[model samples]
Target: MFTHAGTLQHKFCSVAQCGVLIGITIGYTTTTAMSMAAVKRSNCFHKYGHGAACHVPNNSFMVIFAIIQIFLSQVPNFHKLSPLSVIAAIMSFAYSFIGIGLSVAKIFGEGIGKTTLTGIPIGKDFTAMEKMWKILSALGDFAFSYSFCFVLIEIQDTLKSSPPENKQMKKATAIGISTSIVFYMMCGMLGYAAFGNEAPGNFLTGFGFYDPFWLVDLANICIVVHLLGAYQVLAQPIFGYVESWSKEKWPQNKLISKEFSLWGYDINMLRFVWRTSYVIVMTMIAMIFPFFNDFVGLLGACTFWPLSVYFPLEMYISQAKIRKYSFTWIWMQIVSLVCFIVSLVAAIGSTRGLIISVQLFKPFQSES
Candidate 1:
């Protein structure tokens, strides 16, 4: 982002980066807690009946997950996360495929649920305004799922030099995006086929698949593991920047300057305290407002236009020296304008959803 944007525009990049990074932390915290709860709920359903309440409040899970993340966040930075990333990727696939397989099973066994080209009718499960908000939220979810552009630069920095980064990133982007689209399409299509408009945001965690209770539990565990890895990947860059800047600003401060060894790992006092506090705050925020879909939608809407679309387009035009008011420049601006409007609507819808959820919410209280 800093490489090509105007000097004054660099701040926008930083804002976008920090906004999305903080969002990822909060969203992942909520998600992992929900996943842990889902595992327990699956077990309860298995032991009891499908009609059982199986209510699982996620506040305790969120606290436990925060404790784990406080330790994991102590890992140095993005450069040291290769093995963790690999594990995360594997778990990502594991849960995704498990979900896909379950959807297929439900479709074949129970037959397809009622579906339509245009989706739910006006007065069915949702009112007109509610449906409009949900549609917008769905758009935001799609945007959020593909909002990996911000991490490309960090991933590039971690690559070895042998295969040139630009080339590597090009190939990586192609493969990653292609695979992700296929996976998401299968999940969405099959899940909707199995459950129609009632399809859950997370089928494994939701009530969609409980017969194979053990598999459902396993998939939820996989989701928790994947989120753990993803949390660190999104966090380390911010950690590195903050710690480095603080060190430069306070070079002689003992807490920030000195490092102490714990077992085999060298731990810095400032890093320990700051990171632990950050995780605790994240957990608290998540428990207070554990609206996962709303969080994803708002964060996606916030970052999609500025970070993924506008910044990249501006950078490309600047780097390539495209003439002002030229054909390419005009089209890019047109695209950007369209995306900005989409993002605006998405943000509004997400805010509405969040407000509704908060109204019904009891802070740190169990809800099923």
Candidate 2:
């Protein structure tokens, strides 16, 4: 079903779009891992004092992972799995089930803890509700950029620090940024056009935003899987470094033995701890405030504004020897300031609603 749309309008759905959308989605997720890896690499430099430790491989690992996941998600035989892969199959099934199920919950005005009974009446326009909505939107809007802006800031730092010979790093960072912006804009536009005023709370669910369920599902799954892999990129380096240190600290202990491995870079303990933490934190967020769109919107704005807008301009002003203040630079600053303001508004407006979810997720009937 998803493939059909790609085929139907090859222009809007060309190989480039497929590649761009999937690549950017994966890049965004993968960059998190890369950032983690960079952090880990920095640690390695600090601990062993090896200059080579900070040398991160400038590769398209994120893109490869995204492509593989996208392809696997569409494989016909995946739906008809053998007994050996039952667990894998079931995990995939579970993702689809929960992903779509939670997405649908928002459309009926049921998600985000707002019930038909207690929700502000659609036609009832009290001064309180208006103020509440604005503040909630502000908070959510700002928070949405939490992850995004960090990446931008990191990229700027990298670009400024990298030697001119490190062309590969520059290329990779450029690809990551350019692709991400395009993807975000396209997805946001499509979602708004499709869902209009009745969009769902989730970012990728495409509930009221887009009707092509299977395509949207595939996209969401690809995105989620890509993001999951990204977690590993960071985890591996941190765990590896920690394990190395632990071995040095306690060479004879069996507990430390299990924690570190000299070969294959095994770090099961670290994986378990980090993944458990991630799941717990994300689940709390999901359960508490399913107003995903507002959350995403705010986060995006905050992140992009700080990194892309503020950090870049600030750094440029401080670092570069200027003959005069360029109009382009001034214009960029203005744009970033506007984005920051908008995001702040969205975040404050939406925070009240996170509390609202406690009431919504209260003991609903379970399907047997």
Candidate 3:
């Protein structure tokens, strides 16, 4: 869409208006990093016991992680981070394989049962409505897992602008999506097979295989490393936007692009300040809200339809000049409308679920 509009800035200024969406992306990126840091710290608590000196408080560790992210965020441009990004991708695959391997081993040794096959708690006394809500919640989470369309344009922008760039991007996207689906299904099915109703949000957390403690430690380390790099990758766009805005507003301010040598690395003062502030703000939000999965579901519900479904079809319809009330255009419009309705309901359901889960809102407080 941005490419069709000449430039991303032009697209944002025109029909693809979404300044707030970019802000949300940046905020979500840092919150994700904070969640990863919190999980890593929790692993420490589990390994060493709560009171051990090595165990760090979650908020404190998040702050430390935020500081690390601030530096990572200052890496000038996206291309410079490609090496680390590749490593992060590998780490992701490594952890997924370890998780699947562990789960399969456990399932084979313990024998499969009803929960392993169905993944539904056999004796739960959940009402039909409650069961429906749980299914919807899971659907919301699954949607979140596949919600990367918003960033697809940005990723495409990274590719070399050659004649076949678009074709190359489509192929790359197909491969990445196919691989992710396979891995997700394998891990989800096998993990549930191993732990069933006992599986926690972080599957690795439930592992107590002391005989292979190093493998678990390695997996946790990979997660931390991957998140650190992932944070920088996501922060780059926010940094670009902020830097461009600052330069436009204060072209006379030499400090906006002033470079100072820091430990032999040249660092821009404005870039450092604004990116650091962004990370700090996100870190604070993460500390306050801390429900990682719920937050992801809520964010996904709010943005997925517009970013992933409605906009793309609308853009195509407009760009291709599809005749009004024609079959293709009408069918696309119908699909988009249905998606919009679904997204709205998901957003409301996710918000209500979050409030209830957190005990922040009680509609029947006086009834009982």
Candidate 4:
């Protein structure tokens, strides 16, 4: 609401939101494929030995995920995705708990893995630069995790006005965000404590806990299910934007504007062609990078400043009409500045990491 429709600020905000949406789509594609690979790898390790080479090609999995998304994207619009989103959220919680539980088991069984205050030390295997990159990338991951505010407004719109929507939303945001933070911290801290400096970016996929292989497979399956729904949830905004723009631009074109019924489902030619192509392109990008950490860090760092920090702060200031240079205004500005710097450094670190990953990566490689 604060964007003030038809203004330049609205346009910029739209671009930022779209950037975030696309970034999330790509990130989900990459992660879901990895989860699929992890499930197969888990079975491989169980059947054979943990040391045996059981490499799964990520490209195939990515393509399969894209195909599923292509079918799901045909759903009329974002609001129609409520059921899928709910299911996805449930799956998310399932995997998060499983991950934490696995970590706790590891800590109890093996004791804590080696740890240090400064994190992984400078050695022949890891350099100071790499270490810095890791720290920044980790910050990026945190930023991404907490960047759920983008949907806060939409969620608030769904609440009844009997309780005062703003007040209700305030309480909801507080409770939801606090609960999420605790869960995230628990999972992160426990994972770190269980396996310290060598902690994997994805505890489940990293094979940090190989045994109880069935549980690992189940967790990975939850992740895959979550991503299946999440990929469409994230893609909906993009599809809405493109489809709306196309209709307006080509109002008379039947291909863009016409809708038909297919067994109680609304099918539009533009949506079919455009959405399918979009998924395919995203799948290819996922296959090409397939460096989960670097991609997450890059997306999180690049979008976090504008979407999660800057725009919200600016909107709040404008809405609140806080006096210029007032204490509140100044503090808000300081926070924004700090966040911007964090985003910049994170972007640089993730970029450097992505470069290194690319140097070592082979596109569509069948084996690790």
Candidate 5:
């Protein structure tokens, strides 16, 4: 079935086909999972996990590009070239290697740690930093996944605007959530299996499915696509709210120009400005933070944690009309709080380690 799906994923057809499949998958997965979760009244509607999924199409690209960006941003002093852009591309290659290492460490290291943390004996020779990285990576994963959960819950709530008791909506929610969870687990497992020890510098390298050459190539393409997609998704709500607010406050300015639509909301504008901005931002990020592996910790702490752990609980407790501050609410809140704390600690640890590494290697900069 997936073979056929892959064959159908030819450029333009891929987007439409993927959307249909994703929608169908979300619809069914949400229904079943939510139904079961509702029966048990478990706080399964994690927010972060969903937020991560919001960038599903471009997650791969961001993961890959972010790693490259970390290194590329610093490589200018290493060598000078015409236009300076060539140096950026060179740095990107180095960044890819580092990202691979990080990914390897994350998947294998974290996978082994999780096993041992549960009382299984994997090994005892791991260094303090290695152990720390493993733990931090797992925390990053959870945090990353949590953001995706936020998106899921919000989507469900929006879909079920009136009381949200419809069977179809519930089913869709369950399916979406479950699908995301499964995809995450599989990616983690497969990546860990492949990289074992010589992983990329970050989670992106640990994706496990793609080799370095293909990964980079695909990532380059995805960078462009993702930026466009993200802008579209994020801008829509912004534009809607802005337009609405403007209409109410300044009736004279309520007349939105057709050019603005062409700039973004319109097909021509979307293809032009969004595409250009997407490339520029991605290029900048790639150049800035070339070491995606290092950034994973930061990204998880800054972006993922806020979206997943913080927002979801706030949404559930503060927004849910029927969900009073009962046992479920309290338990969910506690869990969310713990997850956030853990994410913060892991991020701090990773950052500290990186800082120390930089400090120790400061004198050896030219050698590197």
Candidate 6:
């Protein structure tokens, strides 16, 4: 959409403003995955009768994961990661289905478990302000889950323009969204049914059945593998931006070749260094905070709101040259304003939660 606007202005201007926002999202997504991998590792260890001494620190696992990511980041191009991405997608589906199945089995064994209707009480417990804040935080999470739109342009760019690429992209998007919604609903409803109010931040960890220890271990392993692949996918865009920036800044640099020979095949050195450094920085952040849920909530609130809601609407309005006083424009403006306000509230709530968590020095506890 922004590309078309260049013709109107008689000059080419890319959406460089989005570069920073996308970079932040990629960093958060990578770190969040690393933190979750650590949590999963800790849980798996505890499940296998590991004593307290066997409990590796989250930072330790994070560092190890970072090393793995650094190696994987060396893959020359995003297209090369397609095979790993396919495996990751299958693993994700397997884990989600396994979780749903396990929850259903548990429910069959033990009748309908207790559940909560509303997330927060209307007046009995939290103040009105607190309730509103919590609701907004939940909204932020929902927005984040649906915020793959940031990557849509990249995916669409891969398609040939000769065909009706836009139409094909729209169809693909609808199918993808529909499938995700169904899977999310199934997994969420069943998970809540099984664990009720005691559900852990990660539903997979909440599963405590030992009779199926092998299956549980497999699921945990899949989670770790999927996160590794996912981290690469999210970080690729940042790698691209850095590579492009470096080339633009130093066009005459002979070392900045498109490909470098590695094991009889061409590899991009710029891709390797930038992506590896990005992973390293993300690893450091994960080690510093190491709180998976808090980081996810905070990232969703602070980044996804602008990337997912505000930018797309603004871009569409600009590209279409919608009049300021038109009904469609006015309605979109109001919606964007509301999204911005809600995002602000969510961000404040997330910050407060992180502060309390830090002050309490809550010991990391993984489900056994």
Please report how far candidate 4 places residue 263 from its true position, in Å: 6.2
- Per-candidate TM equals 0.95, 0.46, 0.80, 0.93, 0.46, 0.79
Q: Please, what are the lDDT tens digits per residue for candidate 6 over residues 46-68? A: 56654333333455555667788
Error of 3 at 88 (Å): 2.1
Candidate 2 lDDT trough over 10 residues, lowest sum: 15-24
Could you tell me which 10 consecutive residues in candidate 5 have the lowest summed lDDT?
36-45
Model 4 TM-score (2 dp):
0.93
What number of clashing residue pairs does each candidate have, in the order they appear? 0, 33, 0, 0, 59, 0
lDDT tens digits by residue: candidate 5, 167-253:
666676676677667656665555445454443332332233233333433443333333222222322332334445555675554
Writing each residue's lDDT as its tens digit, candidate 2 over 1-368 gives: 02322344334323322222222332343332243333344445555664343454323333344334443332222323333133333443454444444345444443333333333444555567665685456455434434443343223333534466357556756776665555445444443343444444444432332323344445455444545433333223333455577778887867656645546544445334543444334333333333334445444443444444455555555556433448866776677677677656665554445445345644221110
| lDDT (Cα atoms) of all candidates against the true structure | 0.85, 0.43, 0.64, 0.82, 0.41, 0.63
**Where is model 3 more than 4 Å wrong at Cα?**
2-56, 116-125, 150-154, 206-211, 261-264, 360-368
lDDT of 4 at 4: 35
lDDT of 6 at 319: 78
TM-score: which is higher, 1 or 3?
1
**Per-residue accuracy of model 4 over 1-368 as CA lDDT, tens digit each:** 44533488787778877887787788888888888889999999999999989888777888888888888887666546456656766887898899999999999999998999988889999998778878887878877776764456345534676888889888878877887788889998999999998898888988888989999999999999987876766677678878888899889999888888889888889999999999999888777787888888888888888878888888788888889899999999999999999989888888888999899988867232
Q: Is candidate 3 or candidate 6 better by TM-score?
A: 3
Residue 26, candidate 5: C-alpha displacement in angstroms: 26
Task: Between candidates 2 and 6, name the one with more favorable lDDT.
Answer: 6
Residues 1-368, candidate 3, lDDT per residue (tens digit)?
Answer: 44444465346433322433443444454444444544555556667865544433456656667778777777666535447657877988998898888788788888653373434543557666665666566655666666665345435545776758879888878877788789889987777777776665666643423225557667766777777776666556557777898999998898996789989988888987888888887777656655555666677776667666766676687689899999998899898888777767676767767777668733212100
Error of 4 at 249 (Å): 1.7
